[model samples]
Target: MAYFSVRNITKRYAAHTALSNVSIDVPEQSIFGLLGPNGAGKTSLIRIINQITGPDEGEVYFGNEKLAPHHVDRIGYLPEERGLYKKMKVGEQALYLAQLKGVSKADAMKKLKYWFEKFEIQAWWNKKVEELSKGMQQKVQFIVTIIHEPSLLIFDEPFSGFDPINVNLLKDEILNLRKNGATIIFSTHNMASVEELCDNIALINNSHKILEGSVKEIKKRFKTNTYSIDFDGFTGPVNPLLPGGFVLTEDKSDDDLRQVTVTLPATATQNELLNAFMPYVNIHAFREIIPTMNEIFIKTVHAAGNHSINS
Candidate 1:
């Protein structure tokens, strides 16, 4: 059973449709990625999920039960827009936020101290939020978000202002949360992070969902039937030796290694290409090329744009 499910959700603001019949199923204890460009309704969907706003149509469910107002306690949201009180001390603000989430003051302080010490930010405990750098403030917010240990966590652009070191630190913490049984909805423009962390994803475009699936399955679905091969000891032009249905996309040589990329025609198979190339040169490595999430995101959005025009 899905840990959380959004069923045919639709949201509108005045005359503008922010989301259109969007639905997603988040599996328990897994990292789920929500992706889209600006004005693509990702934020709207998130707001609806957080119960900060309501959908005009459809319902949201946590497990087998309908979502209720009190269910907000079960979720922790770190929005894209930072919300720290600039004049307030980090530790004080964190304690207040945790208490609001229903954590006892004693437990909150204990957890906060552990987190601060772990992140090496205990020195900033008495410092005002305005005194810290953007990344530092982000770290404080992250601690508060997870302080209550909610079952569901939603993070939007969680790594927006961090250096590589801090980015990896946060990544490790997110993975640890999933391992400890928290379902995470991670929204970001960083395709590399999605590739590294997400088990599944849903891509939205112009208020509509254009793609949704497990990351590996989505990449496979978008493949262009291309393969790269590395070889050596080729004496002549290798293009002509390719099978009739194969088209060489790139060919280059570095020392004794000849690297070539080929697009397979509909009639050709990987076995056929291997059979044809093996005779021409010493095959070093041959592997099918799958599209990256970044490439897939662009192509899918472009297709969605063209679809809107054609319709």
Candidate 2:
């Protein structure tokens, strides 16, 4: 069952419709990706879910209970924009935020110290927020967001200011959070991260949900039935030997080994392709070419007839 689900939620601002009948289901203890181009209503829906704003229509439910103000305590949100008091010391600021989230002073300090040590930022504890770099401040903000240990986490571009090493570190922590029973709604423009961290995703464009499903299933659904094979012992052109309805899209040879990619007919099976090539070439490796999330995102958005989305 879905731990959190939005049903036909709509939001408007004056004459503009920020979201139109948008809905999504986030499974418990899983990372659910919320994806869309700018001005696509992703932020609007997030605000509604956080109770920062009310939807013009529809409902949001957490488990079987309809979303209410009391639900705010169970959620942690890290917005795309950073909001920190420049004059406050890092350690003090974190403690204050944690207390606001209902954590006891002693517990908050203990948790803060643990996270500071983990991120190797213990040395910066006494320094004011204004003295830190953008990435350092981002790290502190991230710590505050999760310090309360809320049941559901909403992270919008959480990796924005981090270097590659820190990005991977955050990814590991996010996966670990799920293992520890925390549900997450991740929103970002990084398609590569989506492929790595998201189990499922819902793509919103033009204020509408255009696609939603498991990452593996979506990639398989959009597959083009293309396969690449690397082999040896094939000296001559295999086009004449290949059965009808197979197109050799690419062929590369280096001395003894040759690699070729073939597009099979829609009705053809992997076994059929294997049987046809086995007689002529020694198959070393055979694998299907799956489209990446980046490729799929562009294709789906364009197909939805939004021409100015790239702008």
Candidate 3:
């Protein structure tokens, strides 16, 4: 059974619908990407899951049981909007937030110390939150969010405001968390991160889910059956060598070597494509071209005709 499931969830505020019949099943110990453009109801669904807001219709399930108020303690959320007590000392505030998540003060301090050392921010323990840079404050917020070791984590744009080095640091930590049996719902506009971290994803646009599946499956589902070939030596007109239902989309040459991209008919196989081009070109390398998450996201959203930002 899915560890967490959102079932036909719908939400509306006045006349504006934020989400409509949206659903996704997140498997345990997997990184699930929650994706969409701004104002696409990604935040709305997230808020519902965190119990910050209630769904007007439909239900949320955790471990096959219906979600309840008490489930809040089992989930960790790091919002895109950073929140900290600006006047409070970093360690003091972190301990307070951890306690709110049900961790005792003593334990929170111990965990905070470990995280601070790991992040090389031990010097900032007594510093006021306002004294830290945006990135530093973000690290503290992240530490507080996960200190309780919640079973399920929801991070919305967690990498925002960090430098590349810190981003990689956090990325590694996230992977480690998953390795240690944490189920994650990662929401972000960063397609490269989604490709690298997500096992599965669901894309919402205009308050509707336009796509959802394992990352590999979704890419394969939208594949165009295109293949790129690099070859040398023999060169001739591709039109005559082409079999029925094959078209060369690109052909470029450098000296004796030439590279070509071919689109195969839906009914055709790679072997058939290879055989058709064998006589005209000395094939050096061939690889199937897979669409990237960015391409798929734009294509699907455009196809849905919900291109304008709602907010």
C-alpha RMSD for every candidate:
1.7, 2.3, 2.3
Best by TM-score: 1
lDDT of each: 0.93, 0.92, 0.93
TM-scores, each model vs. reference: 0.95, 0.94, 0.94
Residue pairs of candidate 2 with colliding backbone atoms? none
lDDT by residue (tens digit), candidate 2, 217-273: 999999999998999987788798667999999999866779999999999988888
Q: Taking the candidates one at a time, how many backbone clashes does each contain?
A: 0, 0, 0
TM-score for candidate 3:
0.94
Over 162-201, each residue of candidate 3 has an lDDT whose tens digit, in order, gives 9999999999999999999999999999999999999999
